[model samples]
Target: MGSVTVYGPPISTAVSRVLACLLEKDVDFKLVNVDMAKGQHKSPDYLKLQVLSLPSPLLLHHRTPTPSLLVLMSLILTAYADRGNKNLLGRNGGGPAERAQVEQWLEAESQSFNPPSSALVFQLAFAPRMGLPQDPAAVELNQAKLAKVLDVYERRLGESRFLARDEFSLADLAHLPNAHYICSAGKDDMLASRKNVARWWEEISTRPSWKKVVDMYSAPPA
Candidate 1:
């Protein structure tokens, strides 16, 4: 099998999501850190490997680069079918209904969950850690937005153990990195308050794959 390479900082939630998927798929891969503070991701070499117009955390397999998380997960699944882990996407993830549902929730994570969670992480955690000023208004706004999104998730999760279904899928995995950050930012109440949402978070966030990713990025004990 061709080797996999992931390019992005470990602290990046998107990058962490990709890493978690790769780990869950049991794909051997190398991680190349991109220094966003130094604008390394904007370098000419990095831009060529990435779609440039889309997003960061490019996945490269045998020199072919793809920016789609779905594509990245599919590639790993295809390469390792003998590993017998077919449920990540679902039974025949390519099937019309399953594919659509998975894609829909994936979109929700990207559009709905990520934005506000990112805002909260930046304002509440990243800024203070970087000695930058946190914006109270931005923090409040994102907190409210995240609360609303979680409310929807609580309802949806109450219907199903996982976002795409009772089985764990990429849809639920996608939320891990950001949701972990939200909790780390001392906003666990957002999740703890919602029984179903908290249950869902606990289930996915404790996966061995995510635990490895967390250890990889965790700060050293003081």
Candidate 2:
């Protein structure tokens, strides 16, 4: 098996999300912290790994080149068997219909949930910590956007136990990192205001994998 290395900051929700997935799948990985504060992620060496992108927490599979499909299948089977969770995104990921549903919610998390949630966290938490001014307009805008997104979640969750279905899937796991930070930032009311959403959040955020990540990386109180 090739080595798996994750490159990013410990506190970054994006990095934490990947970590939670890896942990849930019981994959052995190496965490290579990139100091964004020192602009290490922007260095030429780091940029080469990421190519033309700036997203941190890049996952690199280290080994001699081989058939991509075989590598992917092997990794998936190994992780799925180790964790015994059939709903994660691999060989055990379910049938076509279920897989499509999971993909849909995963897309929602990346597009709808992440933008406003991440923006609010940045405006309320990271910006101030970095000595950057918080823009009231941006904060208000993102809050409203997140509220709308949660409204949809509330409706959907009322109909189903998990986002994609009754089963716990990657769709639900996708929300943990940013949701943790946002809740800690004092906007938990956004989740609590929606009964089903709150229930769902409570369930997913308490998983052992996420608990470990939070224990390791959550910021201290101001």
Best by lDDT: 1
| Clash count per candidate | 0, 0
Clashing pairs in 2: none
Q: Estimate each model's TM-score.
A: 0.89, 0.86
lDDT, candidates in the order shown:
0.83, 0.78
Stretch of 10 with least lDDT, candidate 2: 64-73
- Worst 10 contiguous positions by lDDT, candidate 1: 84-93
lDDT by residue (36-66, candidate 2, tens digit) is 8898888888777763464546777663322
Against the hidden true structure, what lDDT does model 1 obtain? 0.83
Candidate 1 per-residue C-alpha lDDT over 137-175 given as tens digits, one digit per residue, 9 for 90 to 100: 998999999899999999999999999887888888888
Report residue 63 deviation for candidate 2 (angstroms): 4.2
